[model samples]
Target: MAGHSKWANIKRQKAVVDAKRGKTFTQLSRAIILAARNGVPDPSGNFQLRTAIEKAKAAGIPNDNIERAIAKGAGTFSGDNHSLEEIRYEGYGPCGVAILIEALTDNRNRTAADLRVAFSKNGGNLGETGCVSWMFDQKGVCIVQGVVDEDQLLEASLEGGAESYEMTEEETAEVVTEVANLEILNQTLKDKGFQVTDAELRWIPSNNVEVTDSDQARSLLKLIDTLESLDDVQNVTSNFDMSEQLLSVSVV
Candidate 1:
C-alpha cells in the first residue's frame, strides 16, 4: 500500500477541497440522517449516530439543525421524501490508482449523473461493480490522538482485543481490526482513558498504488478533487498516498 503518511496527506487535501465546494456539509448531514435512520436516533444506543453527530458538531452545525435532522431520519418529523441508501462506486484515477467512492445518497439518479460527470472530467472512468473493490478490505479503523502516548495507547488497544495498532507519532496511534472486534476495541481504548478521535469502519487497501512523478501525482489528485467536489460524494478512498509536492498543485 502507499504509505500511511501519503494517504493521510490525500485525506487532508480532500477535506479542504470538499469544504470549499460546500459539499461537506450536505454529505455530513446525509451521514447524520442515515445514521439516525438505521440506528436509533439517540447517539447513546447508536455508535454510528454518535460519530455522525460529533462530525457535524465539529463542522459547526447548530444544535437545532442536528436535532431536526435526527428527527427526520427517525421519521418522527420530516419534510422531504428522504430515504438513505449506501452507494459504492469504482473508478481508476491517474497512475491507475484504484479508487472507491462511498456515499449515503437520497437521490441515486442525480448522484450517479453528477459522479459520472466528475469521473469523465477528471480523467477517471467510473466502472461496473467489482472493478476495484477487490483491492481493498473492510476493516475498522480507530484513530487515537490529542492526548495519549503510543505506549499507553497500544497497551489500551491491545488489552481491548484490537487486532493491531499503528503508531503515527508519540501521541497518536491507529488501531485496526476485523469487523467483529471493532466495538470492543474502541471501547477498550476509550476505557483505558485514551481520547478516541475517530472510530469507524473503513476500507483499507490490501496494497497501494504508487505515483512517483509530480505530474502523475497531480493528475491523480485532480481526479480525487473533482470526485470529492460532488455534493453527494462522501468519502473517496484511493490506493495512492498523497505527497506534499503533489498537493502543491492547485486544482481548478
Candidate 2:
C-alpha cells in the first residue's frame, strides 16, 4: 500500500475508535443533506447521495436522522434557512506537503475565516483556489480486504471496468478506476459480496511528497488536525507520506 494511503487508513480507524459520536453524526448528516439537495433526493438516482448514505451507515448514523436530513433538503420538512456551497481550498503544509481541503458551507465568509485561522495557526497558509488543485487528479478509490481472492477480484473488477488493483499482505487492497465509472464498479463489487472498506471520489496526488524528519512530520499532522476540526470541512486530502513509526502514532 502507498505510505500515505496506509496512514489514511490508520486515521480512519482512529476516527471510528475515538471520535466524538455527535460530531461524526453531524458531519454525516450534512453530507447527506447537501448531496440530496444539490443532486437528487433519491439515493438510487444520485451517486453521491448513495455514497454519503453508505458512509453515514458505516459511522452508525441513525436512519431517522438520515431520512430527516434528506426531507429537509428535498423541502418536505422545515429547514433552518441555510444554503450550502461546496468549497475547495489548496495549500502547502509543513515541509511543503501539498494539501486540499473540501468544505460544505452555508456561509463562505465564516468558513473561510475559520479555515484561514486553522491553517495559519498550524504553521501552514491557505493558498489561492488553483494554487495546488492542479497537482491532484480526481479518481475513484476503493479499498478492500487484501485477502479476498485476487483472481476473482481482478476478473470482477476488470469486467466491471476498474482501471487497476494493487494489494499488500496486510489484508488491504487499493482499487483505482475512472471517476466516471465509480458508481457502476462499486455497485457491481458490492452486489458480488466483496467487502468494500470505502468507495468514493478522491483527489489523488499526481505525485507524492515524502516527509523524512520527525519535526516536519509533527507539523504536517498538526495541520491535518486543524483542517479536520472545521464543522464545514467534510474531508481533507494531502500528499504527505508517513513512515511505519508514524503510522503507530497518527490515526486520522
Candidate 3:
C-alpha cells in the first residue's frame, strides 16, 4: 500500500502540471459525460456526476464546456450522437509487472490498436483480457489535503464504512472503502470538516514487483506514460514498486 501511496502522490503532482497545460480538459470532460450518461444529468441527484463536475472545476474547465458535455451525455444536445463505452485492458510490463488499463472509447478496434502500439513500442505487450486483472481489486479512494488528526479521521472513516485510511504524504491523506461506500465516506469526511479534494475508484494491486534495475525502471515508466498519452485511456494501473530516487531518474 505504501508503494501505491507513493505513486498516488506523484500522480497528484503530475495532475497539477497536466492541468496547467490544458491536457486534463479532455479527460475531465469525458468523465463528466460518462457520469451523466450513466445516471441523471443533474449533479445534485447524481454522486458520480457531482464528483466529476468538481474535478472539472478544479481543473479550471469552463462551465459552458461542462454543460455541453452533460448535454451530450444526456442526448439533449443537437447532432452529438457518439456513444462511449468503458473497457478494461490488461498487459505485462518489464519484469513481469502486471498492468491494467481502463478506457472509454467509441471505437474499440481503434483504441485496441492504439494500445497495442503504445505497449509494443515501450517494452510491453497488450495481452488478452483478464490476464492481469486478477492481480488487483477495485476500491474507492478519497483524497483529503491539509493537516488532519489521524485519530479523528480514523473515527470518521469507521463511521462512514471506510475500510482503511492512511496519510500518503505529510499533508495528504487517502481513505479507502468498498465501491458502494465511497459516496458515504466522502460525505462523512466533508461533514467532519476535512478538505476532501478527490474521490474515484482505483485498482489496488494485491502484490507488487520491486524494480531496482535502472533500465527496467525506465522502461516501466515509459510504458506507463505511453499508455496514458492515448486519448482513450482513462486510468493505467501497474503492480511495480521502486524507490523515489529511482523513480526520479527513470522518468524518461
What's the lDDT for residue 87 in model 3? 94
Indicate the TM-score of model 3. Answer: 0.95
> Which stretches in model 2 have alpha-carbon errors above 4 Å?
249-252
RMSD to the hidden true structure, all candidates: 2.8, 2.0, 1.5
Residue 203 Cα positional deviation in candidate 2, in Å, after optimal superposition: 0.6
Candidates in descending lDDT order: 3, 2, 1
Tens-digit per-residue lDDT, 53-139, candidate 3: 999998889999999999988989898868889999999988888999999999999999999998888788999988999999999
* Candidate 1 segments exceeding 4 Å error: 1-5, 9-21, 242-252
lDDT of residue 165 for candidate 2: 83
The whole-model lDDT of each prediction reads 0.76, 0.81, 0.87
Q: What's the CA error at residue 87 for candidate 1, in Å?
A: 0.9
Clashing pairs in 3: none
Q: So what's the TM-score on candidate 2?
A: 0.92
Task: Output the number of the lDDT-best candidate.
Answer: 3
Runs in model 3 deviating more than 4 A are 19-22
